[model samples]
Target: MASMLISLSHFCDKHGPRILLVTQAAINGSTGDELLVPTYPTDSYCESCLLHFPKSSINDIRSLKSNIGSQCFVSTQYSSIRYQLLTLIIRRSFSEETMIYDGMPLVFYDDIRGLNLVMGFKLNDENARGNERRYCIIFTIDSTDHTSSMQLLSENWNFITGGFDRMVKYICNSHKQELERQNNVNDEKSNFNLLGKTYLRGNKVKVPRNLAELTHDELLFVRLHKWNSFLLNSCMRSSSE
Candidate 1:
C-alpha cells in the first residue's frame, strides 16, 4: 500500500496550500490497479508505488464501508457537495484559530478531477492589521465508492452536506459583522467631518449637523463648507460688537 500527498497551492495561488493524502492498496502487484484507501490525509495524493502495470493485468479493488474518525474530513457522493463541505471545513478551522481584523476574503475550489481541494486566504490592505491566515481544503472519494453497499453511505453523506452548509452560513455572517463594524467606524469619522466642529455641554466634540444631512459624501461636503462659513461669520460679528 502507498499514499500520495498533493499540495493544492502548487496549482492555484488563490487557494493557499491544501493537502490531500490518498492511500491506495496495490492489487495483484500492479501499481495502476491500486485500490483507493478511505482515510483522508493532510496531503492530496499518496500513491503506494510508481510501478505501472498493463491495464489488462490489473484487477479492480473491492470497496468497503468507510470508518473515518471525528476529524475534519468530509464524506460525499456528489462532487459539488464534497467541494462545498471541504471548503467550509477549512474556512471554519481557520476562523477558529485567527482573529479576523480586516475585510480580506478567502476563496476555495476543487480541482478538475474533483479529487483535490484548494483553499486560499489573502489579507487585503483593509485587513493588514490582522494575522495572515492560511486555509486548506481537502477531498477524497467516498468510502462507499469502492464497495457494493453504498445506499446507506450515500444518504449519510447527504445529511452531512446539509449540516456543513449551515455551518458555512454562520461563518459568512460573522465576516459580514466585521465588515459592518468597519463601515460604522467610517461613518462616524465622516460625520465628524461634516458637523462644523462644535463643543458639547461636557466639552466633548460634537457635529453640528444630523446624520440625515451628512448621509451622502457630496451633501456632507457642501454642508460642511456652509456650516464653516456661518460659524466664522458669527464669531467675527460677536468680536466686532
Candidate 2:
C-alpha cells in the first residue's frame, strides 16, 4: 500500500490538474460572462513536469502516455472555445457541478483515456463571486501499471478526498487571516493622530522640550538618524572592547 501510494504520488506530480478558471472579462466593448482560462499547476513538482510534455496542455495531455516525451512546440490553444466546450461537457458528465454544490468529489473512469481515472471537485470560497468563486480541480490519471494503481486509488478514496478538503480549509483560513490583518492596519491608520505626542512609525518618541517643532517627515528622519547613530556607537564600543 505504501509503495503504491508513493508511485501514485509520483504519477500525480507529472500529470496533476491545472485549474480551469471562469471569470468575467470585457470582449469587443461588451461584458463577457464566465470566460474560461487555464492556470499553471499549483505544485512545483507538477510545474517542473511541464518541462517534459511541451506539446501538450494539461487537458490535451490525456492523449499522451505516462512516459516523458521530447520537448516540442505546441500551437494549439487549450483555452479555445472548442476545448472549453469539451471540458464543460466532461464536467457535466462527471457531475462536477453537483460535486461543487454538494461538497463531494467524483472519481470516474475516463471517457476517452480507457482504464485511466478522472477526478473532479471544487473548493468553496465565501468571498468569490460568479464563476471566479469556484476553485475546481479536474485531472485524468495515466499510469503504466493500471491494475494496482486503480485498486489503491479506489480503496483509499476517502483518505484522498479528506486530504484535499483539509488543504482547501488551510488555504481559505490563511487568506481570511491576511485580510483581517490588512483591516486592522487600516483601522490603526484611521485612528492615528498627527498633532499630539511625537510618533515615529506609530511608536512614541521622546524629544527635548526645548527642541523646535518638526513636520512628520522631518521627525521621522530625526528618529531614524538617532537610531543609526546609536547603532554605530554600539558597534564602535564593541569593536574597542
Candidate 3:
C-alpha cells in the first residue's frame, strides 16, 4: 500500500494527476446502468476543468489504506479527490443532473490547513473461501465541520509541503531519533523497576476495626449471625428449588 501510494505520488511528479468522476453506483441491476462514469479532457477548455473543483482544484492522488496506515506525500494541490468504498469515479459531465454533495466544495477550497485527506476504495476479504471479498468506496463529507477530524487530518502529514525526497529523508531521520529516545526512556524505566521475583502474599493487610479483638459475647454474636445466614440461605435455596 505504501509502495502504491509512493508510486502514485511519484507518478504525479512525472505525469501529473489523473482526474475521475465520482457518484453513487446503482446496485442489483435496479438502474441496470452505471451510477457515474469518467469524463475525458476535451480540446474546449472546460471552464470547470481549466479551473480547479473549488478548494482551488482537484487533488486526485487519493486515499490511504489501513495496512499502510499513516502516509505522507507532498500536498501539491490545494485539494485532492479520493474515491472511497462505493461511490468514487473519474470526473465527467452527466446528461442528467447529479446529486450535489454540499461538502465536496470544501475539498477544492483552501479554508482548512493541513487538511490532506486520503480518499479511495477498500477491499475486504473476511468471508470464508475468500471469494466473497468486496471493494467498498468510503467517504466523509462533513470533515470541515468536525474540529477533531480537521485537527487530526491537519497534523502528522508525511506530505512534504516544502521539499521533496530530501525533505522526506530529514523528517524520517528526526522521527527515528525521537522514537529511539522514547524507547531508551522506556528501557530505563523497565530496568529500574525490575524485580527478579515477587511474592504478592507478603504484603500486609490490617484487620478491620469492627472485627479486631472481639469479646466472647461478640464472638458468640458472630457465630449466631453465621448460623442464621446459613439457615436463611438454605431456606431460600429450598424455596427456589
Clashes of each: 22, 0, 27
* Residues 108-188 of candidate 2: C-alpha lDDT, one tens digit per residue: 454343222233333222222221122332323333455754665555456545554553444345445655665688667
Error of 2 at 10 (Å): 23
Using lDDT as the measure, the top candidate is: 2
**TM-score per model over all chains:** 0.29, 0.35, 0.19
Expressed as tens digits, the lDDT of each residue in 12-47 for candidate 1 is 223332322222212222432223334233243212
From the highest TM-score down, the ranking of the candidates is 2, 1, 3
Candidate 3: minimum summed lDDT over ten consecutive residues — where?
1-10
Which ranges in model 1 have alpha carbons more than 4 Å from their true place?
A: 1-145, 148-153, 194-241
State the TM-score for model 3: 0.19
Q: Enumerate residue pairs that collide in model 2.
A: none
Misplaced by over 4 Å in model 3 are 1-162, 196-241
Candidate 2 lDDT score relative to the true structure: 0.31
Q: Which ten residues in a row have the lowest lDDT in candidate 2?
A: 2-11
- In the range 1-241, model 3's lDDT, one tens digit per residue, is 0101111110111122332222221122233123222353444332111212223157532221111112112211112233331112212111113413221211221223212232222111121122111111111222344554444333322322212233223323443564466569867766665654532332233221111011112232223223322322332233234
